[model samples]
Target: MSEQNASAAVNIDITRIMEMIPHRYPILLVDRILEFVPNERAVGLKNVTFNEPHFQGHFPRFPVMPGVLIVEAMAQTAAIMVVQTLGKEAEGKLVYFMTIDEARFRKPVVPGDSLHIHVQKTKQRGPVWKFKGEAMVGDTLCAEAEFSAMIMDN
Candidate 1:
């Protein structure tokens, strides 16, 4: 890890994450943030389990985590970075997806997997920010995407 990343590494639990973004259970994909670099980047984790609602209807025999939700996890990671960058005043503010590009699902994510989400800021213009994100299971890349979003008040 670079000096910046090493200096910024900090643990953010679900409660703090909830205070930063407006997502709740079922929709709140990120379980914890392992590393955060304010405006630069963030690394988060999502523990995939069989109890999630989508698994029941998605595929009972082979419950694969939806690709879209993985992307959403990436977005949520980016949102946390945004909020951290902007400070306490930005808490509870909403981050809305403006675009998702070059999304690719390389491997299927299943229950009992620990999905690690990594997101880095690519650009920023006022409230709008662009990011590149990757979802990984151990060393294997499960999904990746480039996306942009805007922060707004409630």
Candidate 2:
């Protein structure tokens, strides 16, 4: 992490986030980053809607957001934390999920709900980082998980 990001409050706009992470439409889970604490934590936002492609097969009629997607969103949020912590040096770097522990789905996430994803760094070693993540829709916890990932330059 750079000294500027370490001492200063960190925040990244959509354009910069796009340049740092390679995920795109339908797959790019985070819409924008709300806050970053360098190597500590990051908050991200995702506006869920009925128009999302996953709704087609995830459920044809009832249309409840899949649990896996919620977990995926949390993972993406972690990626943002990791990337920003590395001071955007992760450009062209690939982050692969190594493990997910204590994952729990507390409630059903649905269309039209805005997801607030929060991820905090717990530890880091070499290229591996561990994080705790949670997904909430309006104050109610929808899902959460503790996961690890390995960062490698692509």
Candidate 3:
């Protein structure tokens, strides 16, 4: 990230994340925001655990966090960036997926991994925004995708 961008980002915890988005419990994939720079980019955290609901059937013997959920986590992080950019104007609005592209899983995200999600804005036209994202476990890449979402009235 450039110095100009870095200067604008602010860190947020789970309590503030809950205040920013509507997800909760097992569905709230993001644990924290390490960097959030309004319209530019965001970095999120997810501490994977064995107790997650997906582990029950995702694989009985060897469990792995589903690739789709990782994408969702990235999307949620991007959604927070959008909300943070828009401030109070974003309240009561919902971020809905419009498209997902170039999605790939480089490595399986397993239990006890700490997922670091990085998302950057590609474009924004009206209520629709496009973003590219990567999910990683430390320095190892776990998954990546480019997706679009429409922020609409809830």
Candidate 4:
């Protein structure tokens, strides 16, 4: 098999994700992608740190990771799944979250915690894709949502 086939068959790292997705610093919520199964499922990681851009305005003294950013992290992970599945064709394309449904925040995410994000593709029709996403830290669930997005060329 080729390198592309191997990537599709196994877990992907930060470098591979960076090559597919256009998100950069301050916006790239996912730190690394652990596993991907084409259109079926994917796992990603985000390391919460005190130095993140949101920490400055989210709180002054007791900084807590914002729920929206957490959701964005999940979205980024989902984007990785789609991009990896589509391969090089995903470059220069933007994946916009069309809807966020059934979102639940169970716990507060703070600095020094490595959030494990898991996403599974629930459905796909033409340009739109629906995903079920969850974020966890150890045994505790931090956030979860069912969202949809449409891929657009940028």
Per-prediction TM-score to the true structure, in the order listed: 0.96, 0.89, 0.95, 0.90
Worst 10 contiguous positions by lDDT, candidate 3: 2-11
Q: Between candidates 2 and 3, name the one with more favorable lDDT.
A: 3
What are the per-model C-alpha RMSD values against the true structure? Answer: 1.3, 3.4, 1.4, 3.9
User: lDDT value for candidate 3?
Assistant: 0.92
Per-residue lDDT tens digits for candidate 3, residues 64-90, read 999999999999999998998899889
Query: Top TM-score: which candidate number?
Result: 1
Candidate 3 Cα errors over 4 Å, as ranges: 1-3, 7-9
lDDT of 4 by residue, 1-154 (tens): 6654353435567777788788888888898888777777888999899999888887978888999888999999999889888878887699999999999999999999999998989999998999999999988999999999999998
Q: Backbone collision count in every prediction?
A: 0, 0, 0, 0
Q: Output the TM-score of candidate 1.
A: 0.96
* Candidate 1 lDDT tens digits, 12-109: 99999999999999999999999888779999999999999999988899999999999999999999999998999999889999999999999999
Against the unseen true structure, what C-alpha lDDT does each candidate score?
0.95, 0.84, 0.92, 0.88
Where is model 4 more than 4 Å wrong at Cα? 1-11
Report the backbone clash tally of model 3. Answer: 0
User: Stretches of candidate 1 above 4 Å error?
Assistant: 5-7
- The window of 10 residues in a row where model 2 has the poorest summed lDDT is 3-12
| Residue 132 lDDT in candidate 2 | 94
